[model samples]
Target chain A: MLQEHAKLITFFSECKELVGRKRLQKMIYILKKCQFPFSERYQFHFYGPYSEELTLRVQELINLGFLQEEKEKKSGYYQYRYTLTGEGEKFLDHYNLDMPNMDEHIEKMSETSSRFLELVSTMLFFEGMPKEEVEEKVLTVKKKQNYTSEELQQAWNFIGDMGIQH
Target chain B: MSYQSEQLREEKVFKDPVHRYVHVRDRVIWDLIGTPEFQRLRRIKQLGTSFYTFHGAEHSRFNHSLGVYEIVRRILENFKEHPDWNEDERLLCLTAGLLHDLGHGPYSHSFEKVFNLDHEDYTREIILGDTSVNRILKRVDPKFPQNVADVIGKTYSNKLVVSIISSQIDADRMDYLQRDAYFTGVSYGHFDMERILRVMRPMDEQVVIKATGMHAVEDYIMSRYQMYWQVYFHPVTRSSEVILTKILHRAKHLYEQNYKFKLAPLHFESFFKEAPTLEDYLKLDESIVMYYFQIWKDEDDEILSDLCNRFVNRHLFKYIEFNPNHQFEQWMELHKLFTEAGINPDYYLEVDSSSDLPYDFYRPGEDEERLPIHLVMKNDELRELSRESDIVEAISGKKRTDHKLYFPSDFIEALSDDSHIKKRILEILEG
Candidate 1:
């Protein structure tokens, strides 16, 4: 059975903090690509790779007092921010007893993770472009993501800088 | 934009021989396929020594992996109309289906047997370890990689999800039977997988087929029976497997006795120690194993060199159907005769028995996790498949064991003529 926050608490334990839902999904998706033992499965959904389970699990964590969510009205709509609570930290510490490798997984993910998580996730969001077609696919994908060529490179460059070995 | 419409720029497909086109829609799946670990499957043959029996079985696990994914994809589509289907588990099922065979090494059956390795455990390692596949799975969700492994591992709480890839009538079998049949150019494994999938419905804890598809289920069971005996159990493949097992045993024996060699068995040192690390095990595939076998051909150890040459050159030992109850005296006589003739029976004689072979048409309580296939009756009550389908019932729980006595025919024929031993052995074997 998947615990409410499940490995997400362990994930936040590694990152210290993950801000918005979009950022959280993108980062976790990147880690999933690196082959972390996550239970959420993603698709090339709205805002790069997305997992409905992540949303449900986050809500579950909120109910279970592991994560705190803050909501603010911005431009006539609600924007939310999330962070680990005191209890959440304690929960992570207690539940992560079995995960001796969490720190190493986080370190490896950071090296492979990019600031332009959107750009890289967007690059991967395309269904099946091989190495050769990556350039062309990215060109068209930029329009859908509202990303420029430079931003794509920055995301692509960040992945390159991380050394891509993890 | 709403949160769900993450369409790829285009649909991607792999040209698979059995499934034709293995469609990819998720960027995560496409990337997972590109990872070095997943690509390593290309070097690991699907059926191992079965290639000697059916040359076409040279297809790698990669081919079968894609086929499994495709079958799951089709099955998922069929489940779309069912009310209990959890759309959120869609990606999980597909991911599990694709990566289920991730941990297999080159010549998986023999290698795992000799080294006491389980590919299922390795699948978890690759998914949970700091590998590219793990990284990709993490992107789906932080805990997704493990869930995928769990589904493959059959530990997942979601019974329907687990059953899709693992149960008696799961995508893994549906794909392998057809794919293996296609590669081997055999007709026995062919069944209407499409109709069976169409009739499938997600029940509370199991995937059930409608009663209308009972005929199709019967056909699949029959096909499974045929494939097990006809292709998967071909005596030639078992002969090759016997030689392979003996090779590993001999090498381990030599290493234990501190036997030195012209070419060091570097790849096998861990295995010879009987404690192979994950790293050590990951490094082996068909190519490296073949390289070692080739090296052993010129070794100073005569038995080792001879066996290696036989395996490498496909001069496989011959086998006869051995019924122990009747042939017990003959079997004993062969062992004594071989010993008297100066041949080591330990290396030269083997009794290969295949029972509970993988993908067996098993009944419930026989397997730990799997629930036997159930059919939705006209009154909407669930009925076990074998209870209603005679074909399935006839074969279910039946352990059809094939025993073969394998020995070096050429060596026996070259024995001294005055003993008249070779003549008697040939008469018994030929009969």
Candidate 2:
């Protein structure tokens, strides 16, 4: 397996099961921000950060029967659930991938709502900017989301707690 | 006193074959167009080697840039009355539209592959660096340049603004499809862009098309599909690209080996070293590249001279359908035979694959999953395009790929028919 694809497969192996397309995108982006060896490039879309490279890699895994994807219809929109298949587990058992212990972080992020993760990822996208500036940008760009001041502070606190930002 | 609000005394128009007239009413836009950096676009071919296949595809990035700006201008005009539209981002959209392709080097896709450079990175550098375009943008506001870069980079805070410039059915694609088709004289890129633009609504997050305009959207998607297969990824163009890419590789390899050229590759020096300054990058365009190709035909290095001669004279490689997976043994045999036959398989043979997903819904973990086009259905509901249109649904999530083994058939043909090596090679190639 390709190194990049293996890294993602290892991520799946650690997390066990992940849900929601938007949530998956945000989780990977936030992990990338926290400085992992994953090398997928992301561009900010309406849904915070999205990587077409990651999307394609996951598709390749699914096509190879190394990953499983289930589409669940919810509230007139479709949500995706992802898990490592038996082949994925068997393949992983063969390759000794040296990855940092990230199960706690992955599990915690997996439980968070996709909407909040979207905010966190967006905030991380503007991570270099001043706190006030990032907030202003989020408020302006995400006017539709109606993320309140309280929510912004919560995101900032979450970033600190996650050690995403000091 | 901001230059952003500066209006021209009269609307300036450039006679565009695709957009009819590229009208510029903003002084900032007019001046930015006059900058030396922007003017360099005229030297870069829009379709690169596509002109070899489509004789009339001799248009430049200058032509396509204006077409994109014109499309964005028209879209903004329609967007003026929408409640979701913020009027202030108008100049940013126009600037981003016009300057989007500013960083494209000569034969952009091929050059980027060889040099490991990105045009988008160059674009950001040009906008943010100490250049005339950057200076002009700064006259608007200190942050204007960054905002424009962010928009082009698709990281702008305003998704609605970014969507206008780069969404699935945005001005960039609309312009290129029409302009490339018009120049290539292909019928595949024609779609009712006017209808698509009219139905375009600036939603809170992204642009959405009215459900009534689904047919036009469908047509646009089909146009893109056809254009990719028939025009963009045409095998003849790919063959030329293969030769061109091989030429760049051979040249770079020779340069690394310190093979002295009769004429110094001054323009490609920075690119060869993989650390091109903005000035170094700007100095190179298609004309400069072609000049090098014309001169390097007489180079001391055999591979460099041969490849350069081929590219300059349009003596492109011929190709046949090849699947490396299924034909690995045969491919290895051919490689060995080619080497025995005194043809360097590395420089002389290649397998190029082109794949495209014509249309796809927002399927998580899918290949080439762009933000799926959304339709504003009746009763104020939003639906993904593939869900609404059968034409789109049939092709959704289908990725079509073509792999071809490209090589100089003339080189193989020139070998003596009586030679067993040539005979076996021909047998394998023909098989």
Candidate 3:
């Protein structure tokens, strides 16, 4: 089996159930920025950081019955919920993936709203820049989001809470 | 302020083969087209080595860039009064479209693979760096260059603007598919662009197709699929790319090992060191690369000479369908056999793979970065494209990959009839 598949299944196992495509993309990008071994290449899209490779991997997992995707209509749009299947768990048990602090980190990330995760991931995307510059960029590029300073501060604090220095 | 929105007395137009006439009413666009950086695009081929396979594919990035700008101009014209669209981003969108491919070096793909460079990154740099493009953009506003850069980089806050240029179906892909098809003389890239443009509705964050225009969108998707398989990923083109990549690798290795060249590779010095400045990168064009290849064909290094000769004279390597996963042991044996047969397997033998997902939609739990084409139904609701179109759905998320083992068939055939190594190589390759 490909290690990319193994890593993703392990991620599903850690989170148990992850919802919303945007949230899933943001979570993995944040994890990758925090020095996790997710190897998907991310490009800046309308929805902050997105990885096509991750999406393809998730689809493959679904096709193999290793993961389950449940779609629910929410108001005006569709929402997705993902959970590892029995086959996913069995497949995961075969590989000893040593991802320390992943469960707690993913759980903490999952609990947060997708909208806030977008700001967090966007900030992390410019991780090397000064905090002030990143904030300025977030404000400038994401003008439509109209993120308040309070939300920006909270996102920075959340990133810090994840043990990411930036 | 006047200079920012200055228009020429008469609308300037380039008589284009692809877009018919690339119109320029804005003085800024005219000035931008005259910039040294923009003019440099004439030296860079749009399809790279596809010209070797399709003799007519000699179009330049300059040609494609103008086509992209024209498409955006038409799209924006259609979008003028839409409530969801912002009229203020007109110039920014056009500028971004025109300058999107400004950073592409000569033989961009092979050079990028060899030197770890990205044309998109350079595109941003050229827009923001000390160049004529930056100067022209700054005339609009101090922040104008950054806005255009962000749009091209797909990082602009205005999702609608970014989507127009960088989305799944956008001006760049639209122009390239048609322009490359026109230049290469293939029919695979034609689609109902006018219908798709007419149906495009600006939502809060993206451009959605009306359900009525779903067939046009499907046609566009199938066109992209066919173009990828037919022209873009042609085996002959890949074979040329393989040789081009090896030549760069061998030259870089030779340079690093202090192998003296009859003519010093000054143009490639920074690239070989893997630290090319923006200026160094921009200085290289397809002509400069070919000039070097022409001279390097007679160099002292046999491998370098042979590869350059193969590329320059179109003596390309032939390939056989190869599965690396299933033939690892056989490949290893062939590698040893080639080496024993006095052929360097490193340059002479390679397995290249190319894969593409034709189109994809939001599969329940799967995540995608590409904004899946959405159809706005008659009732003002949105439906994903693949879900709405059977043709798109059939190919959606199906990533097709082709792997080929390329080698010099002429070299193998030149071996003695009874040469044990040659027979064994043929047996392994054929068997």
- Residue-wise lDDT of candidate 2 within A1-166, one digit each (tens)? 1456678899988988888767777888888877887876677665567776676667666765788998787775667789999887776665567888788788778767878988998888887789998999888766778998988998988888788764
| Predicted model with the maximum lDDT | 3
DockQ for the candidates, in order: 0.01, 0.17, 0.22
lDDT of 2: 0.83
- Summarize candidate 3's per-residue lDDT along B135-211 as a digit string, tens digits: 99999999999889888878777888988888888999999999988989998889988898899989988888989
lDDT of 3 by residue, A107-162 (tens): 88877888899999999988878999999988876787899999999998899898
Q: What is the lDDT of residue A3 in candidate 3?
A: 54
TM-score of chain B for predicted candidate 3: 0.97
The reply for model 1, stretches above 4 Å from the true place, is A1-166, B1-7, B356-359, B364-370, B420-431
lDDT of 2 by residue, B21-138 (tens): 9999999999999999999999999998999899999999999999999999999999898899999999999999999999999998788878978788899999999999999999
- Give the range where candidate 2 chain B is weakest over 10 consecutive residues by summed lDDT: B355-364
What's the candidate order when arranged by decreasing lDDT?
Answer: 3, 2, 1
Q: Which stretches of candidate 2 lie over 4 Å from their true place?
A: A1-42, A48-166, B355-370
